[model samples]
Every structure is written in structure tokens, then in C-alpha cells.
Target: MRLRVFEAYRAAYDKSPYAVAFATCFVKGGASDTLAQFKIERAESWDVLRTVKFASFSGLQTGCIQHFFYNVVFTRAFGPQRTMLVAVRKTLAECLGYIPFVYMPNYFMLKSVFNGGSSLSEGLGDYVAEISGIMPNRSFASRVWLLCRSAGPLC
Candidate 1:
């Protein structure tokens, strides 16, 4: 099950060369510190998600790494909010500059598949919109909005 989810995530992110580069940057320098930072950020996001009644093991599994590197690092450095959801949205928007917009939704979709007994594409369009709104930047939000517009509703 873990392997399946990981493979799905890898496939999604691997589609983008920039994501690969960012991931390489994350892993090569300060690997241990980066991992520890990731873990702590994951725990923080889990705590917030749990509080918000949005908790899911799949969300944790898929989003934790992203929440760590993307959300935590950038937010700590220059983003407006320190909260988990805020960080996530900011990170998603920033990543959209580098990776395909489908990547994040696909990650959530895989989580839904593994943990929620849903299709890989199920509920993705909505989730993408929600995340886009949470993002601070209008440019990235517009891009995500365009993607969501093109994506037909998924049942």
C-alpha cells in the first residue's frame, strides 16, 4: 500500500524537471537536518489538520513531506503566515511556479485512494480550488483556477 502511494507520488512529481531539481536540493545538502525539519513540520501540520477535523492518515503520508520542505521552509523565511494550512497553500502556489498544477492534487488523490477508498481522480478538482484560494499569491491562484476550470467535475 505504501509502495503504491509512493509510486503514484513519484510519478506525479517526476513529471516535472523543476520538482526533481528542488527535491535534489532538499535531499543533498543538510540531509539529516532537512529530514528532521520535515518531520517537525509534518507533526505541526498533522496537529493543525487534526484540530480542523481534516485529519487523515493519507493526508499525513502524502502531504507531510511537502508541508515540511515547501511550506515550512518558505513560510519561515518569507511567507505571511505560520499556520499549517496557510503554509500549505503558499507552498502549493510556489511549487506551481516550478511543477505542474496537477501534482499537488494528484498527491491528495493518491491519499484518497489509499485511505478513503476513492478513485485516483475523485474530489481532486475541488481540493485544487480550495488550496488555490488559500494561497497568498494571485498569479499562482489564477493558474490553479485555470487548471480547475479545464478539469471537468469528477464524480
Candidate 2:
């Protein structure tokens, strides 16, 4: 069953990167959010709306853009050569360029746009603090990325 499922996913990914990426990202986002709610909020039941909001943001925006990033930007810029320069540049560019400029802002926007809350204004500081909580791991993760040399930041 597991092998069959893996084969099916591999076929889907080979057939349509966009759809596979979107679906995976959608599920990932929802699952991560669910885990967060369970761990942090101590929720007894699932929050379907929050999960949907996360899915929409992750699938429609992040997944699509990330496909371009992995297929075009990272592959073109970094390539498979795996030089120190490539690793350094890719890490810096992804960490500096994408996380702040592209990723987080879009996340906030999507959260605000979908949920219609004060995340932009009043809750901004809270979000920043939240982001700061996971701040240090990025360097290590990027370094691991250098070793793995996977598809993209997400992949």
C-alpha cells in the first residue's frame, strides 16, 4: 500500500508539478496548522476554517510561486554544480530574499485577507515575535539544504 501510494504520488509529481506541489503544500499547510493548534491552543476539535485558510494560502500562492522558484530561480542560479558559491548564494538569497521579502509578507497578507483580522496592524508585533521564535533554525536548515541540494526551499 505504501509503495503503491508512493508510486502514485511520484507519477502525479512527474505528470504535473504544479498540481502535485499545490496539493502537497495545501496538505502540509493544513497539517502543520492543525498540529500547531493542537500543541499550542490545546484544541479539542479541528478548526476546519483555519485549515482551509492555510490550504488556500499555501496552495494558491506559496506552492505556485515555489514551483517557479525551484524550477527556475534556484535551478538556474544554483544549478547542480554544488559549489561553495552556489551553496552560499542560494542560502543567502533564499534566507534573505525569500523569507522576509516574499514568504512572510505573503503569509501575513493571506492570513489577513482570508481571516480578516488585525494581523497587519495590531497583531503585527505578535506575528514578528512568533516568527522570531523559529528564527535560529533557518541557518541550520539552509546549511542542510546545501548538503541535500533539494528542489527548493520548501521541497
Candidate 3:
């Protein structure tokens, strides 16, 4: 298994980042779902459909969307030659802009999936309830967000 992983890693370097990101992120997404299902949750049977859905969404978001985001932010928005301040500024902007638009929706969707609610309305209600329940911990989350935002790894 280690040998195979090593060979895959070595092989990836020859390909474009987009291709590598899509493949690896897809694998990682599926692997994560498998771990959650079989290991963490200790489920009796495989949930193949959920695993595939998670992987597809993960690949689409982490692989494809991220590529476009970086291209636009770095190349088109900020230009190629970036100063530290400029990069920091852009990163902060992205962090602020990302929460409601990207992070919240992704979080809600994934939570809805894992929650196993039968209907969209039920899942959405649960999501809203849980989010509101977490309001007390908002300070802690804010601090973590600030730290992460400063570190500049938004996606």
C-alpha cells in the first residue's frame, strides 16, 4: 500500500495541478467518508451513495472551484506580481466574503448529508437549529477564524 501511494505521488508531479487536485481530492473525499462511516460511526453496512455524493461535492469544490478561485484572485484580481500587503488584503477579503457564500452552504450541505434527514426542509431546519445552538461558541469560532484567516489558507 505504501509503495502504491509513493508511486502515485511520484506520478502526480508530471501532471497539471488541476488534474492532480481533482484525482487526489476525489480519492481523499471518498477515503474520508469511508473512514467516517466504517471507523468513526461504526456503521454495520456501507453507505455507498453518501460516499459517492460526498466525493463528488468534495472534488467539485476543493478541486475545480478552488482552481478557478486562485486563478481569478491571484491572476486577475491582484495581478501576478503580489506584495505581502496586497496578498494579505486579498486573503482577508476572501475570508470575510467566503463564510456566508461558500463555507456556510458547504457546511450545511455536508451536515445535512451526514444527519440523514429524509427531506430538504427537515435538513434545513436541523441545520438552522444547530447553527443557532452554536451561537454561544461563536466567540471561539471567531478567534479560530481570525487565526486561520491570518494564516492565509482559506480554501
Root-mean-square deviation per candidate = 16.0, 5.6, 5.1
Winner by TM-score between candidate 3 and candidate 2: 2
Backbone N/Cα/C clashes per model: 0, 0, 0
Q: By TM-score, highest first, what's the ranking?
A: 2, 3, 1
Q: Assess every candidate by TM-score.
A: 0.27, 0.67, 0.62
TM-score of 1: 0.27
Segments of candidate 3 deviating more than 4 angstroms: 1-19, 80-83, 106-144, 153-155
lDDT of 3 at 116: 77
Error of 2 at 136 (Å): 18
Q: What local distance difference test score does each model get?
A: 0.51, 0.74, 0.70
TM-score for candidate 2? 0.67
Measured by TM-score, the strongest candidate is: 2
Off by more than 4 A, model 2:
117-155
| Residue-by-residue lDDT tens digits, candidate 3, 50-79 | 898788777777876676676665457666
Residue pairs with backbone overlap in model 2: none
Q: For candidate 3, what is the TM-score?
A: 0.62
